[model samples]
Target: MTRTLSIAIKENIYRELRKLVGVGKISAFANRAIEKGLGELEKEQKREKEQLRQQLIEGYQKRTKNKELQKTLQVYGEIPNERNEYSLSMVGLPLTTDDLKKFLPVEVYIENTPTTGLDKPSKILCDSPFTWNKGIRFKKRLGVVSKEIIEKVKRT
Candidate 1:
């Protein structure tokens, strides 16, 4: 049985297909390609379904019994979930040469201690000989800065 069907395809792909397979045989080539693609899709779906079924069976086999559940509950009532917060509470301390030596090559936020006449705190990369004074307090920066920002800071 033969049925006429019209479909839209990309010009480049259509041109290639027409060049490879003549207009008279285009329908046959497309039919074979679609059947092969559908077969592969069906196989993939079956594989996924079997994988999910195996996981379900394994889950059922490993499920804890009522007694084991009760024992776990007794040992730890309403267990708290794991916390993943990465924030640190760092207190600012007066900047000293000793601290600069202690935490060498660390990124720090240096704040002017009112007497330095500086406008705002600056993020600094403490690789070598840092300019320090009695009127400066420093804290380690919690987050990372971009390479561009680092370069800009270095330029100044």
Candidate 2:
């Protein structure tokens, strides 16, 4: 057996319901709304996450660039003479022998000779890491080398 009941709704609410139903079935309309809302929320969340990631990367780059620039600047000031070769003591910049080789010329040797002092000599030395010596030749030469270029080269 089946039974039917009639119910009354406010005029405005009834009009709105009728309009919605006219566009599509109630179930279909509700489902579409739910799907669209969820999709929009997801897209918004993804965009936020991407933005946060970009911000973090940019912050890290800025910080590292600043540190590299500072190191390069300190070394730039201490350009060594022929007698006083550039040493790690000039600046606290952390660089490997390979890095120096890649950035500088092949003639530059990492001098391991101990200097007479209480301060232990550094493992790596350069005839002129910042400036090229007369004997040294570079495969590629930059017109003007700066701390920024050094940092960028190292990053690559």
Which candidate leads in lDDT? 1
TM-score of each: 0.39, 0.33
What is candidate 2's lDDT per residue for 3-77, written digit by digit as tens? 343566588976797686874464556567778999999999989976765675555456553444323221121
lDDT of 1 at 151: 54
In model 1, how many backbone clashes occur? 0
lDDT of 1 by residue, 1-156 (tens): 878889999999988999999888888999999899999999999899767656754454456354332221111001111221211111222223233334434545444435333344443443433221111111222333445544543543
Off by over 4 Å in 1: 64-156
Instruction: Report clash pairs, candidate 1.
Output: none
Q: RMSDs, each prediction? A: 19.2, 19.2
For model 2, give the RMSD to the true fold: 19.2
Name the 10 consecutive residues with the lowest summed lDDT in model 1: 72-81
Runs of candidate 2 exceeding 4 Å displacement: 1-14, 66-156
